[model samples]
Target: MNKITKALGLSLLLSSAVSVYAQQPPKHTYKPDGYSIVTIETPEDVRFHATGLDSTSTGEVYVATRFGDVWKLAGDKWSKFAEGLHEPTGLLVDDDGSIVVAQKPEFTRLRDTDNDGQADEYSMLAGDWDFHDNYHEFTFGPVKDKAGNYYGTLNLSHGDPDAFSLGAMGSSGGYRGFAFKVNKDGEFSPYAWGLRSPAGLGSSPEGELFYTDNQGDWVPTSTFHLLQEGKFYGHPVSLAQRPGYSKESITNTAVEVFDKIREKPVALIPHLEVANSPGNPAWDTTKGQFGPFAGQIFIGDQTQSNIFRVLLDKVNGVYQGAVINFMNGFQSGNIRNEFDIKGQLWVGQTARGWGAAGGKPFGLQKVVWDGTTPFELHNIKLTKTGFTLTFTDKVDVNSVSLDSFSAQQWNYHYSGNYGSPKMNLEAVKPSKVSLSADKLTVTIDMPLTADKLVQIDFPGLKDINGRNVGVEKVYYTLNQLRK
Candidate 1:
């Protein structure tokens, strides 16, 4: 093909992709919050629950199933990429086009040797760490970094479900309930320990690693933690892997001392409120292709069958943020999701063992922005007085007042117990409401403190067009008072 021919072909490909996304996707309705959720049609045999997925520049999408198969979605057909592996949990397509995935025991790479479109070679890319035969000892990632290293989170072995034993959070093998990295030469090094159950992992566009952990023993709620090197994430079970940081040492340590030492999450998703079992988090890097939510992170929930948006603000070298429920009523249990080249969000879900609110067993859904900037809470930035809320639409200003919003503050207790209830509940009275000159930002008055979770209810708040804000409730974890 000549340069002119190649140029024409490239232009046509781009045009076609844009046209497909321009149309309203089929089998999905417009969300009340100005988005559409569509379930993509898969091959009849692609019934296995998907754990992770990634797409290519040419829009070729691939998924790793919990049943140990990788399939590629080309146009309307789901072609088998590879088969017969362990219970794989995460998937990614490298620059060389080889598919990398995380299985229960190891990380594997699938490559099509003969250009036949079927992966002929299945190589164990990493797993030099440790794994046990326990049912809950699931391996979760390969979230790559700019340096070409792969990372994964290992879940600790759990005890019998009928009995609430403390051993449920204990590690049976080496570095269980920890996050580790593997280099190109396949050198495994244990990095961060003390994670309870890391369900999903991914890196930001800036290449910073982050993972989502479920709420359970030693974890008061589901959270998204910044993957800082050699940091403990508040679970004593995994400390058993670190010699000096054993369970006995943590048990003997006072709560005050533990709080000062343990690394907290960037954002705390309230249990059963925003996320029951939070899955993978995908950021909006599609520029304007996915709407105005560029740079914000979208997190999925398994049991709740919902998705929420998080806005992170770095202050004083620490990360803190807010979470707002974006959409609910997804089919099946959401496990993983990724944005395609066209900015379409393909969500992979499975409800095989755990029941979900969507009433489905498994599904593949896509969420697209319908070009509507719905009235919503876009972000919550911490301020000296309290925090400011930026909305998607211009506010009426008259709709906000000292009596217009209500806030409740509480903190969680980390114990060997299954979970925690809201402790020290207190109502916070707002001193004032100040609207930004752009009318898109509102400064609500509330006294915030360190290590406290605030739940603010934006009651009767509406945009200038009289449309009510979709997400009225916003949750913020104020870990740092100021920068």
Candidate 2:
């Protein structure tokens, strides 16, 4: 067997352990063709810099750098638009073309000011005034809602002073938690609290907000927390706090907070040993319900360097949810790990290597949900039958079916007939997706057959809403099916 076939066999064996729900696996009939990886040039002196990317109504894309500067990518040309700011962590473009940026303790606003596409007026919306400690516990950039309100998390640490320290600061409190909002009128209101390091924000189809929190020592031992608005989320207490606060109880301090809120997040995971640092959460509104997430939320994990898509069910108006680790460890750096975009998740790697190491040059990365692409193959033997396709996307011990390819141009086919004749590309699950909220890789065994070629549809897979997935071509070869 060739190396690709061998790798495919092993990959299928590992995919079986993936978490399965009532939904069927997304089918793939073919892969993309004429596809190639294109690497862009990093701006000179761009080392040690993080990125914040946001696109405008036009095709213009704006990127914020870690070194306190803003750059614009107009087509293939990169231009430095703004300079001399603090460590700009996040960036967002508002409805009226205004820009919102997160620069540590302050959330700043920028406007074109002169009818130009570039921002000319820069103003600080909130800050402690002290240059050294105007900490709002804020890091990630603000996300604007259809109602014109801005929302995001503001995490503050509070464990061991040494572990919680950051950016030249001496001993500091661990990131407490956050769920804050800025209204259309610019009025800022603090909502949910008790998050450690929530690096990402996402809104469901129902307009209810959701966030991903990182768990550490003295906190959630193994899982990641899903932030719900107007809820206090027993931060120091780590979910399971229904039994009257003991150790790690932030509920006791509720009276001290102005809002006096008290609601816990939807506990997403348990002891999986998957460093639970869940980051940016984006909802897919196209397939499910209309406005809210329809119970879907996507998050990024820094420690494991991965991403996830969680479904939040709103039965009878009560929101409940579960997380499916979608993407696994990226071959990018560590540190500032993130994935926040409308279509495919865009990962930002700043650490080093594809594993759990740190201190590497930072760069922006993307994971394209190419429905046409075939997942890694699994379990193969060199015997006759031209190589039996033993594995299947599922293991129901049922019959197999042969269907047409999703990519009409490629003419792909699968030997397995157990599932439906029409393969749903949207339902295609990653073989070795993430287990934790972060980027740890867990191999999942997805069964298949030697004679079957999965059909993957492109149009069926849409964005957060029901938008169509666009690609140039579909590529698949029979050679890829054997081990």
Candidate 3:
């Protein structure tokens, strides 16, 4: 009687457990159409707060962590490659198989001299700029151009009394708040000045260098800039670090003078709405492997914990374009993105000092295209009179009307303030709206204006398959109009 009663009780308990498990919701219910996120597991004891990511031609993925360790991922295995770095924020795998990293104090090259699986050789490639031991002085690149020159961006100091302070940031050491270049011969030079917290850097498919700066004092908002030589990028406090300018001189110059000479960013990533602390811009050169948005830029935000797509266009010989929401729901703050040869995007995340939207402190994840194209905005081109909106799929013309679209325009005032509020915000109604015959393009005619951020929303638009557009709003930086 005892054996039969015990067996019957165990069977009922196991059955109840299975029933409850089946009733629970699945882990990833918010699956985005055409893209899926795959989390790569890290050791529980390791911080794994990834700041930079890259891959080798042989398919090994390397990650540099903010805790000063580099890890290599081969298949399902993880191994430490290097250590003892001072918060490396960016990593690159060179053509000759050397690994380069931008640590807070120097640009280092890590190599395996004995053909071991770990990096044994740590060489200082460049450390010309002065470091004042401030926690906010982060270095952020090693993107090599076709000419073999490596580039990087340096962040300004945060709490140094002697540093020239303006709005929210300060610069005291040499070349702080500047973009620098190191030649193949190991020579270093400051390329561009006036950056506040340039967190990430990358090279476009055509070899143009670009960077993402966080919004702070002197910087009205987060920005994406085409890093050109000798250009000032709106942060006046950094001008004190320039060769001829002193702290007194920069203080004496009016804000208007700096504003007049500073080169505008390619795109102003809207503060809070889009990105609070934007990271690197990784261009989609994966052809069709990563889906339809080839040649566009994909960037991640630390505070937003999301990935946003940038559709860039050359208008009147200058780069200005739109920023559209792409994907969110990551595990931590996404700070770096690297596309592998198989066309998957690897995101490195961290939430150290200021924290991030994703509840975790650090993680690593990859985004893969499911081969199904999402019905969304493919690109936004500025026209002579208005804008031409192109979609990834055919639109349902019956679902669109004049009431489906609304727009507003505003400009940010250039000041020494923490961050400028939207100045002179005004509603911009489209004078004419026309859907193309093929149903993949929409043309909106409006009174075009320069130096304004124009946001257009088409909330209820649907594709031919009756699926709602994945992203309904786009923010376009109208710096120039197409002739």
lDDT (0-100) at residue 31 of candidate 3? Answer: 38
TM-score for each predicted model, relative to the true structure: 0.90, 0.56, 0.93
Name the top TM-score candidate: 3
Point to the candidate with the largest lDDT: 3
Candidate 1 lDDT over 371-440, as tens digits, reads 8788888888888888889988899978978777899989888766666788898998888888899999
Cα lDDT tens digits, model 3, 1-483, are: 111111111100100111110121112323347899999998669999999899987689999988778899998899999887777899999999989988877888889999888887788889898777777788899899989999999998877787878865788867899999999999999999888889979998788999988876777877889999999998887777677888888888998999899988889887767777789999887899999989889999876678898888899888998898888888888999999988999999997775667879999999999899888899999888898899999999987788889999999877776676788899999888889999999999888888999999998789999998887899999987787
- By lDDT, the better pick of 1 and 2 is 1
**Residues 332-377, model 2: lDDT tens digits:** 3322322233343345554422223222356665545433332222
What lDDT does the true structure give each of the candidates?
A: 0.78, 0.42, 0.84
Weakest lDDT window of 10 consecutive positions for candidate 1: 10-19
Those runs of model 1 whose alpha carbons end farther than 4 Å from true positions after fitting are 1-32, 160-167, 245-257
lDDT of 3 at 307: 89
Ranking by TM-score: 3, 1, 2
| After superposition, candidate 3 runs with Cα above 4 Å error | 1-32
